[model samples]
Target: MATFAPANVLDFGGAQLIYELASAIFPAVKKMKGDYSLGQVAKLYYSFIWITSPLMFWGAYLEIRRQSDSILTKCKEKKIFFVLFFLIFSPLCTFILLNFSFESKNVDDIRVYLSFHSRLGMPVWGGIVPTSASVMAAMTAFGIRYFCCVFD
Candidate 1:
């Protein structure tokens, strides 16, 4: 019989790993994505999936690859494997996005968030955010993203 770690152990480990990744990435992410948009949400999700999750499997994948005789040949095989995986992965991602998107498809569904962003009105937490501060935040976010994209 095979033994396994407790489910809570695995869950807590995964959550800690994700939290660390978020903490490390938060500076750049905060710079690139300040507002609540689809782009910001996508960046956050993909960064967690691609950058963080890979480390969990990287050692196992490398061990599997090393089963092959030649180093160069094994790397080539691994690359091809991931490429094919991504070919399937991307479409599945799109399908999930499409289905979830259609479920709450209306722009109005997110209108409350958008309206909160407006500089004009909206009492939040018993006080309205000043228009000048909102405008400044938007402009700063735009300028930061622009410079980072253009230079980096």
Candidate 2:
């Protein structure tokens, strides 16, 4: 869950980190006439977010259920939180992707889409980065407690 924020920023915030990583993996992307543009990066980011959003909920459910003795009890307790998490980000990302104009294949032509998505995606997801940090801290503590049985 905490990962959502960073992933969001890397994908939509015009950081080009993802592009750099991709270039490293696929050397052709860095070649003379390779199709390595912000537009291609945006497409990759969009696909990544769409695929991973639902998986976050599943992973959360599995983690929550693993920690709890009773499956039904934990599901009942965390159901609303998980649902709300899915509801909020899914539509926002979808709306941003839908509204972002991806008409052209050229990097220059897709600046509009890049700018629009970045403008909206950055602040919105950036505000949640602190929350994600807190979550990571809490999850780390929970993991330590669970594994070591020191806090049980």
Candidate 3:
């Protein structure tokens, strides 16, 4: 009988750290209220979330399907999909975030808004970087596994 081991320590640790970071950052943003333009930008953010939700769900579906296969096969397939998906989707996400606008009464406030937009831009790159890294890592691991299987 084949037995599947549970996820390792690093995965749980990474998930915990990500959760904490997101939780801490979300409240700071939610507390902020700039102007009517900020509200508009928020609306745009919601729209992006709405549009991306389906893609994320589809990705999750692919992940589940891949997981049901042999580990080496699953890793190879997921790595390819992850790399391709992020390469295509990350720029689209950045574009949406980049074009978001907010109405402001003060020029300084507008500057702040733009600065905030620029800061928010980090998340787009951040998301892509980790995803790409993980994909490459998976590919490496799977390729090694497949090579070993060839010997066996």
Model 3 TM-score relative to the real fold: 0.26
Which ranges of candidate 1 are over 4 A from the true structure? Answer: 1-21, 25-31, 50-53, 56-64, 72-152
Clashes of 2: 0
Who is ahead in TM-score, 1 or 3? 3
Clashes per model (N, Cα, C within 3 A): 0, 0, 2
lDDT per residue, candidate 3, 1-152, as tens digits?
Answer: 00121223114554345434433543323333434333323323333333343355456445644663565464455665534433345444434333342223354664444433433542343234223433433443334435443333
lDDT of 2 by residue, 4-116 (tens): 34433444544455556554553323432323333343434433443343455456545754765553344346655433443444344434433332334554544433422
lDDT of every model, 2 decimals:
0.34, 0.40, 0.39
Q: Show model 2 residue runs off by greater than 4 Å.
A: 1-37, 70-152
State in Å the error of residue 54, model 3: 24
lDDT of 3 at 67: 62
